[model samples]
Target: MTLDGFAARPLGFVGPLDLSWRDRSAAVEVVGQRITAEVTAIDLDQGLARLSMAATEDSELWAYLKPLRVGATLSGRVVSIERFGVFVALDDGPDHPVHPGVGFITIPELSWRHVERASDVVQVGQRVSCEFLQFDTWQGEARLSLRAAQPDEVPPQPKRL
Candidate 1:
C-alpha cells in the first residue's frame, strides 16, 4: 500500500526519528543501506514493525523471481557452503541481507539419498542449478531443491489416498 504522491518523502531512520526528504529528507551515511520490504505488521506494544521482503512489494525483484516459480530451474554459483544449507548467489536478483546468496538449499533438499555433510554434495564456488521449492517469507529465502533438479531415471509417483 504505497501512496502515489505523498508530501512526506521518507529518508532514513535515525535512532528514534524517521527522517524524510521531499518534505524533509536527510543526507546521512546510507550508502550501504539498500534493502526494501513491506510493512507486514505493526506491534505497538513491542514498538516494532514487522517487515517482509516480498517480490510483490518490489517490482524489479518480482520481475526477476516471477518466472522462477515452483519447480522452475534457477542457476547460480555457490557463494557459501554452511552446515545447514548451501547459499547460491543467483545469476540475477537483488542481494540478500543476511545470506551471501538468496538461494538456500537445505540438507534434506540437497539430495535424494542420505548425506553426511552438505559440502560432500556441493562446494563453495561450485556452480549448481536447482529447482525452486518455495519462497520463505520470514527468512526471505528461496527454498530450493537440488535433488529435484537431477531426478532419478524413474521418479517415484506420489500415491493417491
Candidate 2:
C-alpha cells in the first residue's frame, strides 16, 4: 500500500512504518488476499521499487546469466534497430523486464570499421552472436559487443606509384 505518495509495507516490530527513501519494504502476507511481496528497495528519484522477486522463485534467465563471465558469447535475434544501438533478444534467456531484450549493442561496438549507420552492420530480425561486456545496472540490461564476435577486417592501404 502507498501512503502520502510513498509506498508502505507493514513491519511487525516497527508497526505502521514511516520511513524515507532506500528503506526496505517488508514482505508480509494476509491470508486469502493477494499479499505476495518481495522485499524491495525504494528509489525516490525514479519513484520505483527494486524488488528481488527471483529470490523466492527460480529464474531460469537469471540462473543462466548470473554465472556467465564477461566476454562469454551468446546468440540472439535483433529485435529492434535504433540509431544509438541494437536490442537483441537472447536465445537462451527470458525477456528483459524493462527493455525490449536483455542484450544491447552500442553503435561503436557493432563493427570494427567505421559505421555510418547501425543498419549497415545489423538489421532487424538478424541473428547475431555477441560477446558479453557488462551489465547495465541502471537499465537492468546486458551490454554486448557484436564486433568482438567477428574477426577484424584489414583496412585497405594506399598504393605507392
Candidate 3:
C-alpha cells in the first residue's frame, strides 16, 4: 500500500498528518523580571512582541518575546509625573512619558476641569496597566494612554448612599 502521488493521500486527512502545524516559537526571557515600558507600536515586522521602544533595555526585551497579537496588554511602573502625564520605566531602561493623550487619564480630561498635576491621580512608583496603542519601529518609540487602556467609568460608586 504505497502511493507516491497525490492519489495515495488518505481520505478526510485523518491521523497526525491532519493535525494543525503548531509553531513552537521561543519564549520571552526572564518571566518574573517585569520592567515598565511605554507603549510603542503594536505590530513589528518579524514578530508580535518585536516591539519598538524609546527606552533602551526595556524595549529590547519586549521585542524578543514577540507578543502574539497587536494591541496587547502591558504593565509598567510610574517613575515620574507631570502636568501633561506620567512616565513609566520600560524594562530596557529610561522612563517613557505617558502623555495625557495616550497614557493616563489627565485630571482635566478625567473631569473636564483644571488638573494642576498628574501626580494627583498617578503617583511615583505606581504600577499601571496599559495597552500597546501605537508603535514606531523605525523611531523605536511608542505612545500609550491610561484612559484608553481602561474601560468606561463606573460612575464613582454613588458614595454608598
lDDT values for all models: 0.67, 0.68, 0.42
lDDT of 3 by residue, 62-156 (tens): 35333424466656777667666565654443333223222233344322334577766677887877655555333233445565566655455
Error of 3 at 5 (Å): 44
Q: Please estimate how well model 3 matches the true structure, expressed as its whole-model Cα lDDT.
A: 0.42
Q: List the residue pairs that clash in candidate 2.
A: none
Candidate 1 lDDT over residue span 13-88, tens digit each: 2321222211223324354565454454566765555444443344554455545678888889989988888998
Off by over 4 Å in 2: 1-64, 154-161
**True lDDT of residue 98, candidate 3:** 29
lDDT of 3 at 73: 64
Judged by whole-model lDDT over C-alpha atoms, candidate 1 comes out at 0.67
* Per-residue lDDT over 1-161 for candidate 2, one digit per residue giving the tens place of the 0 to 100 score: 33234446523121233222122354343433432234445666655554443322335544555566799998999999988899999987887655688889999999999898999988899999999998653344678999999998757789999
Candidate 1 lDDT at 120 equals 88
Cα deviation at 103, candidate 3, in Å, is 8.1
Top-TM-score candidate index:
2
Clashing pairs for predicted structure model 1, backbone only: 11-20, 20-24, 20-25, 21-25
